[model samples]
Target: MASDPLFERLWNGSAPMEEWTAAVSDGAITAVADGIITVHTTYFCGSVTAIRTMEGLVLIDTAKPDTAQRTLEVIRSWDDSPIHTVIFTHGHIDHTSGIAVIDAEADARGVPRPRIVAHRNVRRRMERYVASHGFNSIVQGQQFNKPGYVYPIGQRQPDEVYDETLSLTIGGERLELFHGRGETDDASFVWLPERRVLASGDFVIWVFPNAGNPRKVQRYAAEWAVALRHMEQLRPAILIPGHGPVVFGEARALQMLRDGAEALEHLVRETLALMNRGATLDAVLHAVKVPAEYLAKPYLLAKYDDPEFLVRNIYHFYAGWFDGDPAHLKPARTAEIATELARLAGGAEKLAERAAILSEQGASRLAVQLAELAGAAAPDAPRIQAIRASVLQKAIDGESSLMGKAFLSVYQRQAQERAG
Candidate 1:
């Protein structure tokens, strides 16, 4: 273990909930089983897990940029062996960018660089990331509270790409690799049969499974559950999650994976059932729910992704973009609709007043809806914009998920600007 107090508490399974949160967001290195250590690089993306074999060292994820550099320094101080293999859990920049630093280190020492491995789709994802760099930059910036964050260009392509599964024996330690679609289509998880440790990439993040990201591409919710099930069958004694602190024991690891998988499965089942019954998107969004107990688990909190958002992704995958509403098929512009609605309500101020009343009643959803309409109708009205800002601030305060909170903050900033 890292020998830090927080890390010690986590290893003992005696840490409070808030401590778990801190352990992940901040960087640290901890060893689980012998020769297997996980470096929590950056919670915004994922962590890096390194397995030391008799032949050399193998890494699951390199982390990214500055954090990766810091982690690499710590790793070099402890392990001097050449990195023989670098396994990328996924194609995300955070998981792959550390290759640059690793390669640089190898160059400095005049040693062979590690072989980079990933699923074939990881290459395609890297290509897509390069092609859509601008778009990704904007969304990532908004999600992380960086207004103009630019997605790094030219991510490294994996040296080896597998289609289904691959197994390798490094110094008698058997490492099994499998491809399972989850947060990203190219996701892969590592299983060390000998050590009984599972390096579950983003498939098992500490928070809610990011089965659905409102602003991102497709995520496989049902398949994600299947992936977790596969991991549960392995019966790993230690779990190195994509972002969180290492799960120390087998029972705790299995329970956490099951909780995440079951939560995802329940969401998909409920959502698909509603869609099959010809329910509109809005109707299904409000109707579908994961059991309260699933959400109550410490590992399954909606800290990054919400269950309701996953329902939307299910609808998008099974049903197309159409929401089954006739009016939405060719609706008028939002501004046009808002103008007419405000006129009918007497004025934008009237709508804003009603929004304020609803906000005071703790009806944040309805309050924000009305406030947006009011703003659309009269963008220059400072008093109306102030009410809109208040409604948005309330929504921001109530959000549990980091993604939801960051997005709401963007809108709240704009509303505050207009208010002035």
Candidate 2:
């Protein structure tokens, strides 16, 4: 069960560092609203919302592949009613990988297969996932702190696909699905009119809106803001987010939608303004900032994503890969550049030494960069590997965002393994 004190701490933006540290552990399933059950987790991945209707139960997401069976057990414990529909909020593995369990369970019970629902672009997203399966496996492993995780490529094809809006009368209860491009191109949010319950997939995750994932594909920040604003007007009494605890009350839910939308809007608008004024992407990243008031909100914590990343995403959205810097437009290969820097700095050993000094001085950011250059210059140097490992671990320790920490630790672990 979700703890009341934990919710209270999250609600007040006072959750301690210890609580944030424990966010990776699996959470319990519990009811957030009448007839609405949600599984909240640290990050947005694997969280799901279940809505009970007169005809049957409607599942919002299927959770991750590892957690899918557990999620099904929890749902079965609550209601033995067959799942009438399974609506995927997006094509991300965490949201879609659990469908196999649902499929098998339905077969065991001799029930008809539930109608899988999703946006029209979901198929395309899955196709992309298949095409880049290996690449995604490597990158996502680092991003999610699962070093050897292989992203499951199989997805239960949606029987019902909609371009924009789809209305369904499930068991005589009207449910609306709206297509919104936020974290991913194929994202949707569910709206139950009579129940006044809104299931916002990734559009309104508890942490900073992931409009800017550095390693992922393009994220639509402007369109994401517009979608949030649209949902805000509906005045949902209970907001079940893709991640985080369920939000109750009209006012609180509205504020969440409005504020989350505004944060993205502010980033997009500010970045565009700077670009219009001929500022470079690097300049815009440092210049734009979310309002302090919004930053103070518990729901707006930058646990997964941060403002600078969003700024960079907006930059990439409007401008292409170039950051308006001639030097970066056609830069040398990273390894080559690192080799050159090492040569200029009196060899890789000097770079490694400098990085160790920097780490001791608490200059983790600079230390990691120097360590990377050293590692690139001398990939098999035991001394350089040790410095890189120590420096990167320091950088990881200093990072607050889970996304940043995960990526940083990837190199840290690699360096340690190499040294050993």
Candidate 3:
């Protein structure tokens, strides 16, 4: 794990400062060699890349606004070259909010505002953001700890939007932009012909592709696979992703891209088949699986997004969330179920005792459910305290998703308070 500092950071987050510092120093960002340039802007969920052409700097995605200011500061530290163009790979907040910061910097310096370019869908995406700001805030609350989301005000729309492909010359080098639907409908990838470098927006995230985020907007797994195949044919020498460290070799990059696409395709096809056969959503979800060979790939590991979530996403795509179970069509509320479960278990203490046993036996799923009931039924019981602790400890020991880990943290805190 310590050997590959980037993987270590992505996986267990256990690398020493010196190792990570060395990895970052090894040109993770702001790489300048052979008069060609690349910059990796680190932001949450996404990153930005900048390339130096003979004409001026061509920036790919500005990152979050605050992060963009810091990114620009870093770029200035290395070279005083003016940013001639800014390409928005997608209209997601993390990718587009930094436009204002870049605009401010260029404006203050009396440099013309860099040309902002994106796919034609970018304007629609921005419009959706403006229209659904409240919905976004509510959905985002489940993930973010802040009381409210910081909605970007006066977001800059793309100055140039294209449907198929657009070619631009920067510093006498030809950079090609291609539209594709992947993590978002508005995704675009930049191909640097001279450098043989590909800046894949969120189209090729290094982590398990987040095609099935349970909480966010629609993701295009089928289209994402298609895009990966398209990029595979290009055979990029250096693959700078929307997140995580860049891949250095063409063969390795192609293999990762191909494997990821194939994995998603398998799931999409299998899920569709089961749905076509009138299988229940649960049956379809349980049936979809990523081949062991593909899962073995280091880049395709389920570090961030779980495959099961993507399976559910596919089910939603086909059948819009009615699970065919008549009872569940308008199911009893959670509190009602908890009350009944509490009554059946003979109050919270018995339920807590059962949960503790389940936790001890490694049945964490059942344990968590029982613990929740116990906590609701007997909020002040010592058994509730014990159940919470046991459930939380199991969660901490397991390899769960990010949201699972966060929920465990919340449970652990609540348990400690009860114990006190």
Candidate 4:
């Protein structure tokens, strides 16, 4: 019941953009390795890897909260074996929130609840989530364009947490989990030494590593590269990435890991080089670039994250938040500054007009900034609000990364409502 060829096409770099993005969230269960099945979940979420062991099944990732039931159904359709354990690749809500549903399902089946596994920091992250539920809900709403959506905070926590490595034998198959800091500080990647299969959490996603997610907390660009390169050394014959299609064959799998690592390593190295030379964050952001060679491979596409964001992330961990600009260190209020600029520029209408012209000329990067200033200067101006909404949509249309587009959509919707 799976078009396994889709995975093959992705590995070979022949899958068209249309077909590729569609399969990104397709819940189709495909047997990628001998006994391992990969079931992708919704967009912006990780994939569910169901590994059938001798005694029972070992599931790596339960997917986001909304996709939990569907992921469970697919796994059950493939194998009725009781889930012996559920290993979370990380504590990201998109990957860990489904634990509650999974645990309830086990209880309903009259089976022992599977042990939920993760890194020790995962528990810490959950604690932070509990303490900052309101903040997270607002962030998630802006991120997913769910204006009034509330983030589910009652999800179950991991029962088994490891600091470094955890080895488990389920159904006679030994699965090795190695901890690494990637998209999040608490991250784990599974390795099947016998099968040469690697379940790399978000470390080897088939897109630019999300080392620079703008909305999230601290991320490790250097550590993320180290993690991917470490997995490459294992020479995994099959790779089930955290968010994209599975990669079969040793060369294909290694290529994905290597390419992703190389890009992040380049960003980290370049950002550090500039920072060491006393360059500003803005300067380093524009100077560092992803070698064009990686673009040839579809797996390294910047669909989920941007290289510029990764550069900024490198600057974040190495250098302090100061952008090396005296003006930015103690900037005046944004609205006040916008109002002043509008006064100097003749009015908010002129700023909106320039922004519209810039957007039409494909200067979305500049246009969006101007539009924002216009909106701040004239928050109740219908004409300014309309122009700001259009400019925001233009930026969203031109954006190639999902994270950037999602945040832009949130603002655009608000602008539209004000304009109406």
TM-score of each: 0.94, 0.92, 0.85, 0.93
Which model scores highest in lDDT?
1
Candidate 3 C-alpha error for residue 72, in Å: 1.1
| Regions of model 4 farther than 4 Å from truth | 1-4, 12-26, 41-43
Residues forming the 10-long window of minimal summed lDDT in candidate 2: 16-25
lDDT of 2 by residue, 42-125 (tens): 454556877788989989999887778877777777778989999999998889988999999889889998899999999999
Ranking by TM-score: 1, 4, 2, 3
Q: Could you tally the backbone clashes for each prediction?
A: 0, 0, 2, 2
What tens digits encode model 4's per-residue C-alpha lDDT throughout 346-401? 99999999999999999998999999999999999998999999999999999988
Summarize candidate 3's per-residue lDDT along 257-358 as a digit string, tens digits.
Answer: 898899999999999998889998878767889888776665676756778888888788778879767878999977678778889878878888888888
Answer with 3 or 4, whichever has the higher lDDT.
4
**TM accuracy, model 2:** 0.92
Predicted structure 3, TM vs. truth: 0.85
RMSD in angstroms between candidate 4 and the native structure over all alpha carbons: 2.3
Candidate 1 residues lying further than 4 Å off, grouped into runs, are 1-27
Minimal lDDT window, size 10, model 4: 17-26
| Position 182, candidate 3: lDDT | 79
Report lDDT (Cα) of residue 98, candidate 1: 86
lDDT of 1 by residue, 271-362 (tens): 88888888999999999988988877666778888888899999999998899998999989999999999999999999999999999999
